[model samples]
Target: MLSWVPLLTVALLCWIFSAGQPYGLPIAVWAEDSSSLARQLVRMLDATPGLSVRAQLLSRAEAQQALQRMDVYGVVHIPPHFARDVQRGGAASVTLLHNAQLSTASSLVQRDVRQVVGTLSAGVEMQAMAKRGTPAQALQVRLEPIRTQLVALFNVSTNYEQFLAATLLPALLHILAMTAGAWSVGRELRDGTLGQWLGAPAGEAQAPARPSAAQVLAALLGKLALPLVSLWLCGMAGLVYLSQLRGWAVAGSLAWIALGLLLLIAVSLAAGALLAAGTLSLRQAMSGAGLLSAPAFAFSGVGFPLLAMSGSARTWAEAMPYTHYARLQIEQWQMGAPPAQSLPVIAVLLLATLVLLALATAALLRAWARPQDWGKR
Candidate 1:
């Protein structure tokens, strides 16, 4: 599962969101007026990338049914005499009934549809004013006295593939890393090889002899080295795929981001090792690993914003290294913060790794000295 699961999941997630943005969403339109103005707005709605006018019904009742059946995202109802209202210098209404359940799609459709209607309304008003002997420049100024430009500082395209997949890959790897670390150390105990592995040299004894704390730590590190290095390489490969092959922008120094990835891996591995050593049972250790890592992404503020969370919930999020790691990745990758700003988070991860490593080493050493605790399934 470890060898290919993360790769497959990450690839699947990327494929799911490969579309840069949501577009061509189906929307229903009902033009009660049957005027040239209503038809023009329908064409404009279809022209926008965010919406597709799937059906133009004869009556409001049919449009409502279409919306109820979910044949389309929403209905654009043009009330009767809409053109006459515009011609008579009176305000007209275009009613949009959208599916609130599909919030994101509904919002996008609403935005595009509103823009189309607003643009046409302005033009219709300007023409009416022009016919009434109003100056064109004065009409334009009166229509939009204070224009504003909305700009997105990061993830400008709002591409879900880049925004989410980039962060999701790390979370997947983190869970796997902790599981691998636990299994690496836990298996020795499960298989009854802890003594022979952590104690005296080959041919020195018939069974095995307990070694010093140094030997115990050495054995634990040596056993974990392979998996640690392998997962770290996997992390680097993911980074390369995202930033180089996929062409996702890396705002800050890639080198700093790489260091952050390394720290995240080390801390997760240490955490797993600590769990296994403390539990002294492979089954229990693996169970604990799952309970901790499985829900990590949710609490890591990847799916939800930390600022929006309750105070106690945010505190729980702060306690997880994945939270800090995620923050570091966003800071360096999306926010393009300087290396200096990233140091504190890096230090937090590094410190967590060290603390977990120390506690795991001590636990392993204790387990090494007690042969009774060696054989655990």
Candidate 2:
């Protein structure tokens, strides 16, 4: 029972963190000269659910200073002629100074500000049309000369959970598979039983029976079997249980997701085998796996766009197995992309697994031939 505490604790924390999405954030408003229309705009901004007019600044300098101090995420600046321009039926503009360092929060603030400005502009236009004897029924149509409706395909509500959970959960499972596979080899070496485990003679015999390449590969695969199976189970749970609970899109067939999960596990296992064979020590193997897998979540393009990354960074991200897996999940679940789109991603994963497996097998065979290399580190 005590052993279950850490696992339960992790599950609890993930649940708590993901339960509520924060859409509304406080913002500062600075309207120069404080005209009636400016005040009305501020009120409208305050009423918006995405933003709260927490502070009314008298000067731009004060707003800038507050932003610098991190006291506010963004500042809305209404110019001196803002009201006069509106009343005269002239074009008016409001500038938003936002903290680009916090991309997500800044985006929310920008969206809310745009919505408020559009509403105010439409109202001013409708009043102007009324003065020209436009009928009341025509006024509404004139206010919105053109109407546009936005429909999000996969995530209807654009929920954060849908975006975050799908990527994060799979990445977490991949890390666990890597750790477990690495630990299996490390434990045998640390216990001074690796030679016996590999069926190779310890020291003494000049030409001890060296295991064939096939045998070496089999040994590594045997160690990985359980971890791979466990990872598959975890993948199924995320698809059937977590997806249903969170209302995440699962447009692709379950068979495709399962196949992708298998490839993901195979990649992790092959990576772990290569690390163990190269390092030849339990501690070093685990350390190497940690270094390789820790940044997978960020590089998977979950929080940011891959196109924005530099060439070198993008190349590195593409090499990660999780990056391919995440892309497949998004296409299948969210976009409901056709098989033509998804098959390429699955093919890439399969190719990676084969390459890594070959490398790991060769490394293990070399380690088996040279008994002195056992626990070399």
Candidate 3:
């Protein structure tokens, strides 16, 4: 297992950074009073790499309008007293409002906004200390960090590499495991092996018989577990390695990885069982598995902003369980959401998996009992 780690790591690395594109995070800024400090902040962001000032709104209403229309992914509004408060050695409120639909953009914009705000606030304090004839070191001591309240409704930093790398594990694992398991069901019935198992008598020394339903379900789940664990560990570790190399701070706990793994396993089993129940051919099952990637990647908002999506698109996104799971994974991993916050996300995913599993299991049992119906007359 350890020997395979390096090879797996390299594969993940290649997949993640292969895409070459600038971080095109769109942002809108509104300064209530048009203060010099606020204007400076906008200029700084425009000059900053990885960030783009898509538009500048003059009023709070304008900002809200842009957000509702999704003209921008995120908004940064500086209060009228922003400069005055800073100059007076008092704290000022700068509202950072974002469309709940664009969670990823929310985090990215907030992070960069804080960096810009911190630099500006520090400059203000340094000037005040200079007026007091304080040393440069004293100026540093007097500079207080500006607090930013971030509300991410959707992918929050748009860190393409981390997002792509982390999700690749579950996505690939599900495809491989589910496709194989689904194909196996059709193979057993087609090969007449299922009848052989049913006809075999229990030996006198044999222990109490295992429930056929339980055995089949367990076997399917067991087969998926190995790949599930491998993918989870490799993916998380790979992401951590990437973050370290890029000097990015991952905010979520390792516990979230455990939750993510369990969710992936459940999803894989459920999807596999569903495909098996349909008696899909091996090629068809594999094709179905491959089809999952397009929607999974899209609804997860890896490249696009969810806020920018229309209501119809949003409805479609909500239907995909992988979409929410991927979003939660990214939130916990890249955006620094704590375990407590991530628990609800895990709960929802578990509930969805359980529901799907129950329906799939019933369908499988019916399909198994009536294999002839699976074929066209």
Find the candidate with the highest TM-score and give its number.
Answer: 1
- Please give the range of 10 consecutive residues that has the lowest summed lDDT in model 1: 200-209
Give TM-scores for every candidate, taking all chains together and pairing residue i with residue i: 0.87, 0.83, 0.53
Mark the 10 consecutive residues where model 3 has the least summed lDDT. 198-207
Where does model 1 exceed 4 Å of error? Answer: 57-71, 200-208, 369-377
Which candidate number would show the highest lDDT if scored against the true structure? 1
Backbone clash numbers for all candidates listed: 0, 0, 7
Candidate 2 colliding pairs? none
Better of 1 and 3 by lDDT: 1
The order of the candidates by TM-score, greatest first, is 1, 2, 3
lDDT by residue for model 2 (1-377), tens: 11233234335535754754665588998888478888899999999988888898988789989899988889999998888888887888899999998988888888888989989888888878888999999988767779899877667766666677656767877777777767877776666566677765565322367777777778777878877876767666666654676556478765677788889878987887788876778788889889888899888888768889999999999989999998888888877777678898889889988888788778766665665655544
Model 2 stretches with alpha carbons more than 4 Å out:
1-21, 33-36, 80-85, 140-151, 200-208, 281-284, 298-315, 338-341
How far does residue 180 in candidate 3 sit from its true spot (Å)?
3.9
> Candidates' lDDT values, in order?
0.83, 0.77, 0.63
Candidate 1 lDDT, 188-209, residue by residue in tens: 8787677677765554321355
